[model samples]
Target: MAAVGWRGAPGARGLGGTWHPWGASGALSVGGAWAPVGCAWRPLGGGRLAPVGGARLPLRAPERLWGRARRKNPSDPNVEGKRRATIMKRVHMARKKGERIPVMFDEKGQPEGKHGDELMSWIGVLAQEHIPIWIQDWRSRDLDGLKDIIWKETITSFTADESFWTACIKSCGEAAQNFRHDLYKTFVEGFLKEESVWTRSQKVVDIYPNIEEEDWVKFVQYRTSSQFQQLSDRGSEIRTNNEYSSRGGRDGYRKLD
Candidate 1:
């Protein structure tokens, strides 16, 4: 372990950390972040940072530390991927010549519109080719991504309408069957509805992964940090306060975000 210090950052005069070359390595404990242990040194401006005040910044170190300080967070592009996956979770398998129709049925367990005919046409092709195994073949790559593929392509696309429900159920290859359950009809229908399942999941932003509250406390506690000082100026920005309803003590929100 070696102590690395920084005095170039304004008002962070004596900030430093003990870098462990071996053993568990992660964010620094003070107002800065540490790069993962054993990042091979790269040339300045190409990897983590350019030369700073006659010093070459350690790769990924700035991003771990102060790059988080004044970041302008744009929307995550991957959310679009998730949203797209949800919309097509099941319909693409039934596509013919590029257009798709989901295995969606109305509440009455009847195939709605021309979906019955479309299912027959798609299934007819699959049956003629004897390619039920193709489903498994298409799914086997990128094991980490399989959950999304299965969710959007199989389970999320189950149609309860009896007219072609049998075809959809039988069309799945064994690999897909491993993750599915249909203990009851209504449970299947509710989960398959576009609005009822994936859309609701998409709206959630789990702060645990993104907000390192323990790490944040370090920066806030370093009172001499100019970056922390900047955050202090914005601390009182108007925000919603949670309140309870008088009649039943039921909880609700007054969202300001």
Candidate 2:
């Protein structure tokens, strides 16, 4: 059988040749032929050691090492397509049945008044929860994107039809507007009247514990600006001079019904 050998001199730096049972003084016999030990040249024989290149075969490909090369995330186009298709199908079926698709109805398919108000409150709550972190201006994000995210979050516990989903998105817009107004009136206009910047900044962080300090600072700056003040004054004048508006309180226009 072909054997392995090392050709380095006695006590040399490389593998010892005479270390083998058949080796003698700086040489080794593998099937009666001396072979070098620490070189790229490999012995072409059975059961004899051979030098290998530095390259190694990986057990898995790069993509397969982790997972699929293309994976679906929350905002994936395919996922969006599927959601659109489902909503369209639901709308079509409801139309075919000649039914008025209920918005925020209970599981028993009854129109409960409080259900609508609860959903509006939820929309406002979620808008308040996400907007301070994700959006500086409501216009900065596409309405559809916000709708999708909020709809997904809301549906985790609540069940509603596509009509309610559309209403929820619309309410989110109003919620954003209301949120800005509240922040302005409650904090920016009243409490933020402090002359000290440090005091104002501290108060903003205290009011909105979860919001980033930088974001709240920017909001405070914008609301206190002359341009925003002019806009606010104009809006307040318009609301005050108008007499056609109904005082519906928390029920809004539903009081008319």
Candidate 3:
């Protein structure tokens, strides 16, 4: 808290003049004189300040008053989540009205704003809407089916033959694969290593209600197999030996300052 004093001439010092506090020093300029606040406004004959009879104001830093500084990038996860939801709502509304869906790409056939985040949001919504498709083992026919689904659902200016369409499918496939691995790691692998198989299975099913019991059982069996264990071990070894490290989090350079 800081105090402010009214500026008055020597003969009229401490009069009923209104006072205002400004700046970090709690000083205000009146006429040609600077009066330091947080004190009594006594005219020391030459505009010198003395501490007394002043009102205190609560001083707060900008960050404390306003909370975290906003990130500039729209693609930042905090911002992009709302943006994606809004786009999804527009898509639904356009469908209901029997109109062409809102497009993410510009007239020049390039994606608007942050393309990487846009593509991820599209595939993320697609995966969420079509959960059953993601749970299955994909074959060539399945990939083609997913490609068709992406082409129909995602509103982009890119044509069917364009590389951008293929890139969408590829990105979606990678995201789906990562999603499954993350699910397994978070739900299954998180159980105590020493716990019995039955106990772990029951606990996993209890904690992760979204996954069907049958699917969980099958997934557990596959993950526990010798082939899967060997692959996991190989991957661990490779990662352990790797010398390279990322400079930032999963978003990497896309993460805003």
Best by lDDT: 2
Residue 220 alpha-carbon offset, candidate 2, angstroms: 0.9
Q: Please provide the root mean square deviation of candidate 1 (C-alpha atoms, Å).
A: 23.2
Per-residue alpha-carbon lDDT of candidate 2 for residues 78-177, written as tens digits (9 for 90 to 100): 3433533454455456557764344546554323565454445455556656666324455554655766788875564345766566556656666666
What's the ranking of the predictions by lDDT, best on top? Answer: 2, 3, 1
What lDDT does candidate 3 reach at residue 248? 23
Q: Tell me how far the alpha carbon of residue 167 in candidate 3 is from the true structure, in angstroms, after superposition.
A: 0.8
lDDT of 3 at 92: 65
Write model 1 residue lDDT over 1-257, tens digit each, in one string.
44332223343211332222233444333224335443332334354342323234555453333332333211232432343344344356444335445545545443445554344333322222232211323335444343334334433334443353433434433212221111112222355435333221222224112323443233223432576446546542322232432110000111111
Task: Spell out the clash pairs found in candidate 1.
Answer: 33-65, 89-152, 89-153
lDDT tens digits by residue: candidate 3, 25-99 = 755444344446433333233333333454332221111122123323432333444655765775566668776
Question: Candidate 1's error at 14, in angstroms?
Answer: 97
Query: Clash number for every model?
Result: 3, 0, 3
Q: Is candidate 1 or candidate 3 better by TM-score?
A: 3
Model 2 alpha-carbon miss at residue 69, Å? 61
Regarding lDDT, does 2 or 3 come out ahead?
A: 2
Location of the lowest summed lDDT over 10 successive residues in candidate 2: 57-66
